[model samples]
Target: MCGIVTAVASQDVVPVLIEGLRKLEYRGYDSAGLAVLNGGLRRVRSTGRVAELAEAAAEVHAPVGIAHTRWATHGAPSERNAHPHVSGGLAVVHNGIIENFESIRARLSAAGYVFESETDTEAIAHLIQSKLREAGSLFEAVRLATAELTGAYAIGVLHETEPECAVVARRGSPLLLGIGEHGVYAASDTAALLQVTRNIVYLEDGDIAELTREDVRITDSAGQPVERATHVSSLSADAVELGIYRHYMQKEIFEQPQALANTLEIIGGGGLPIPQLFGADGPAVLGGVRQVLILACGTSYHSGLVARYWLESIAGIPCTVEIASEYRYRSSVPDPATLVIAISQSGETADTLAALKHATLLGMTRTLAICNVPESAIVREAALRFITRAGPEIGVASTKAFTTQLAALAVLTLTLARMSGHIAEDVEARHLAGLRHLPVAVQKVLELEPQIEQWAQRFAMKHHALFLGRGRHWPIAMEGALKLKEISYIHAEAYAAGELKHGPLALVDEDMPVIAVAPADELLEKLKSNLQEVRARGGELYVFADAGSEIPETDGVHILHMPEHYGMLSPVLHVIPLQLLSYHAALVKGTDVDKPRNLAKSVTVE
Candidate 1:
């Protein structure tokens, strides 16, 4: 998905628009452009970062304009395909795709509309221009144009005839209105306007709003006036600052303790979670749930896999984990009593949202979302929600977000256990105490960075790496491999320690590095034998072992001891070093740790 920002302000709004686009660069960074209604819609665009567009638009004097940083969808990433697509007097910037654009473009072409850019967004501009020529209001023209479209979109449009007014609309995509002292703004996300204003109104599906410096008027698809509640954002501009860390990933890794502490705040002054943590209907949903189906993608999917272990072992509930992208395409048996949980950091993940809706369509009405953003689509769509407090994860490869998801899932596990009569009070109390001490344990885990860095130095030189673990820690190994491949650009794979000789051992050699996660659990001896198999084959071992495991370092074998054995919460603590290893390896290889190539922070489009 792309990022869009539009404003109808009292002062010269170009500077504010540029700053907003800068903040939204994490959403998309291929190319950027801005259009101001100065002397009949003057515009500047670049096939570069937003900074280049800011430099090009330095002289824009109009107080009304729209801007976009595009992640290419219907065309190549070039200056010609950059957003703020213009036709006649209409300029449009869009986030989602126009699925029926080919048909619409052919019709418009026959009607004597000349297109300049290879973009679905350009078709919208021409369509709007055609409607505006019918002698109707701007809002009416946009409404008529949107009725013919067939896909997801959050669009901002500005017409030269009415320079002081801007119109924005959303359908199956996110758009928020920022009410500020000097102007009203529309953006794909709230982070764009956090610096300028904290008052936000999230537009619902099929809603359109016309904005000006003095007023905003929202209406539904039927042209009926609709009331939208305004919310004051608690996120200050400073929370997003890098603040001494070399990269946001590094900063977020260090922020894990704080994030987890905030996430665990719901279990305050008591051994059990606060009744309101899951919402008003939480108890009924958890108490009535016959099973659980978790839908997620990427890092969230790995977190869901870990939660499967917790749900089955601790909560005594049957649980299944599914990748959102694949789940939507397959026909699965749905049980109405099942609790469908969707895990997403942005909560706007396209496939995950589709899968949740698919489940709902199949008579699975009981749903919950463990999301980071409170106002995300997944939160609104689900019947219940748990908001993780990991704020502003700007890294393309997730760090704090993954750890916080695990923390929230643990809370869910304990709550479900209490509801299901599977856990005793003493066991629940012990788990609560363990959760309380989790942040401190994670902080101590951060102390292993220098040791992990020494290991990363060796890893940076290897082209392929093997990550090994078993049981609950198996998902942690998958996450470790994901982080390494995502940031460091290394080819890494994960396998269960017991599955080494099954097939993967054939690939282990002197050139391959095998990373093992051995926490002194019941399977420690079995894992030791697996490591020996690798060592016998001349595979260098980089082992992260707990103190009780007593795994020694000899010749080709290297060991970094963990602080302590964290029992049930070992996955949460064990993931920290893998994050550090990935970060350090990427740093040593001179990779872009924050914005990895070919990846966006949020996968809002499939």
Candidate 2:
């Protein structure tokens, strides 16, 4: 998940580049760098944060430049491996991986080009420079060079010879051109360009654009000229600002109620949701879908896992949830009647996109994308999509995105249940009522944050944690464990409550903390027994129980009551405390809560 921002403007763009990189810091990067075409190509890089890079480039100024915040796909996170990789007069900053860089590097090496870095982007710089010798212009050279490269990439290239313009290309990764009065800019996300301009042109895959101060020219993958529509972005710069919250993670954790409310606003009129809420052709798609194959990764995968229970039990549809990365590589039977639901917070997740394509290649035509970003690649590729209204989730550890996704999936479940004649009218109305009241319920759960923060004080001293849940809440436990491990840097694992004695109980001890999600569902007694297993093993227990489960507090047991149980939607409420726990624990541990180590938001590379 690298970030790119390139500008060819009338005024000095160094400050713009630095500010853009600051906006993209939430994507998670190890190093930052920029190359400007002044009289000559001037470059600066830092193996630190963007603020440090800004300090290093304080005196540097240029009208045309390319900048990057690198996430280190091809090499170690060092200044030498940072972006704005140069070859002769050309400099390149890239997002996404170049899969065939080894062969390109080998050929460039044989051609007397010396390599200074171990990055695939370095090979790209060399290849583009070599092409410039034969091609007439920088844009032509970039287009020709990209044709030979393999894998996903969005790259911005600047040549000192072509000081008036910058060339940008997009393949599998996202790249947009910002049209401003004084300049044209290219960036990986709109957040980076929002400060300078709201007018944006989202480039299609394999489209290349040449940006100058006053003009932008586009060429498609086939080398034919084309035009892409420019739309005014609705997102303001303040959406990314951390107002009163200490970190983006904390801010996002508290924004869940509003996010869910916005996502479910279509059905807020006290009526059953129609399938068309998903897309224009949702009725036909849902009518043909006899089974579901849900594909997703990370937090999105946990959402899909939770959906498996809902789809099967509520809609009476057989469902299978697969981790996107593994699903793409393996051969499996594809059913045309099965709806392939690809879930992602940022719609650009590489594995999920690849798996969606793989399923399509196998002849599964009924595909739906449950995502947050409307312009993301997965949404464009899927036949139908439900865009969650969780606006601009800047935190690397997703909170609002996860809850909004659950809200969307719940609506999908009810729609399918109504279509399949699996639900009575009264039952459907009750489910609809629960969804209508979801935001209020979530807000009440958020009210318990202070108590959860106290629990986090205890958890911060421990290095290992185990999360347990039963039935549908099992995936909620999994999500809870993931959040703890992601932000708090704790070794956490989740298990179905019944599976504790099978193997995981061996690791439970007095020093280890066990967190359990105990909603007052049918499995309350069984989950209570699982907590007893942990208590019997001298494992310190922290339980987030329902209001009336009556799981009494005793020695070695700490219980924080949720506002209410929420029936089938309990997973939505249960996950909030876990998110708060992770956030507070990370705060106590002095870790980066928004940008966790060795992880990035929107995983664009394999």
Among all candidates shown, the one with the greatest TM-score: 2
lDDT value, residue 194 of candidate 2: 87
Local accuracy of candidate 1 as per-residue lDDT tens digits, 309-350: 999999999999999999979889999999999999998988
Residues 183-209, candidate 2: write the lDDT tens digits: 999998899998899999999999999
The TM-score that candidate 1 achieves is 0.98
How does each model score on TM-score? 0.98, 0.99
Clashing pairs in 1: none
Candidate models: Cα lDDT each: 0.91, 0.93
Judged by lDDT against the true structure, how good is candidate 2?
0.93
